[model samples]
Target: MTGDLGNLRYISPWYGGGMPPDPSLPNRRDARRNRDLFIEHAKATFAEHGVDASLERIAREAGLAIGTLYRHFPTRVDLLLAVFEPKLRDFLATAEAALKMADPWEGFLVFLEALCGAQAYDRGFNDFIARRFPRDERTEVMHDRVCQLARSILSRAQAAGVVRPDIAEADLIALLWANSRIAEATRQVAPGVWRRHMHLVIDGFRAGDRHELPEPSLSPEQLYRVMARLGE
Candidate 1:
């Protein structure tokens, strides 16, 4: 990964490097070129505007015609949905890549950090997405993907005798969601307190099912609602 872009995850020579040429991007690269360009800018636009960002703004930023944007996305929701797919793919890819860490616990911690980062940043967007399209198939698929990946990691740690045998996938996801809450609450009080709580939680998780636990983590929907109220 480092060899490709030297730890700059967002730099894609194919998608994000720089514009190809004027109007000639096609007859050159693969399909979805314009769509990829739209996704790149849309993410930035959405970050600033939440779900209210205009398709016109996205197309202007991407230097594409509005018709071209609609040709690919068809609807604003389609564009949002498309941009979200690869964003999450990047998220899960990072977690899976962390499995290469020499220490199981360290890898697990990094995975938790990845989750925390997403919650800190994308949780709002995620909630907006949920409200926009409750039970979206893509979101459901992502939920299952995350759940399965966490379960696999838990199994790995348990097999290594470092994690509790009874630790379910739900437990880790809850922990990540909880840590995000702390991060949101104490962001002004101190930076990285959520990271601190994450380490503490990890210690408890490693201690396994024998230990008393904090409150169960909020469901994804509940977390979204809580964060929305926090924003309000």
Candidate 2:
């Protein structure tokens, strides 16, 4: 896992790569204020409505025109990247630390706990992690890196004789989807309930004398297509 961790460096493009200068900067002070207002409202709106939240609604909440919103963020993905960049950094940091843990199974558990905790706390992040946006090159790169990390971790656990060899990366993706749903449903009535369920699922995945599953795991291409469809 330590050797594999070195190959998994994922500096987010939003932070490292040069993005275009803020278009609102050249305009009057009011334009800069409007841009700030839009981002503030957008954070709340996306928190409530997920990533597909309406740009027009965000503008309205900001008391700015839709055209102004467009001037600040030409595309939904642009706004999304801005809104999620901080959260993404935090998540990636946690994941990276988990990958460096000495015990493969312990590392896997830490990763899942952090991932699921993020999903449970933020509806927008839950949606963000579950789907694939192929047209957005930066987002696609991030998603692919995340998937690769999951595969590496899973394989490490399997090789360590902790996790079941039959489990695949697709299975972990499926578990993420399941965890998202469970978190959403129980968030209001029982906010911490998902942890119990997750632990039970983890117990099931542990290597032991267990019943053989009849179905095959999804192929890598098949998993990619399925996640893309979910985005659509």
Off by over 4 Å in 1: 1-77, 100-102, 125-139, 187-191, 212-232
The number of clashing residue pairs in each candidate reads 0, 0
Task: Itemize residue pairs with steric clashes in candidate 2.
Answer: none
CA RMSD per model (angstroms): 11.7, 12.6
Scored by lDDT, model 2 comes in at 0.84
| Candidate 2, residue 177: lDDT | 84
- Best candidate, TM-score-wise? 2
Query: Quick one: best lDDT, which candidate?
Result: 2
Model 1 C-alpha lDDT per residue in residues 94-178, reported as the tens digit of each score? 7887676777777777777777766565543544423324335655566566756776667777788888765666567567557
State the local distance difference test value for candidate 1.
Answer: 0.67
lDDT (10s digit) by residue, model 2, range 1-232: 8544433433332444335456776677887788889889988888777888888899998998999899989988888888877787788888888888999999999988887888776788777887888999988988887887888888889999999999998888888888878988898899999999888888888998989989999999999999899777
- 3: Cα error in model 2, Å: 55
Q: Name the lDDT value of residue 215 in candidate 1.
A: 62
Clashing pairs in 1: none
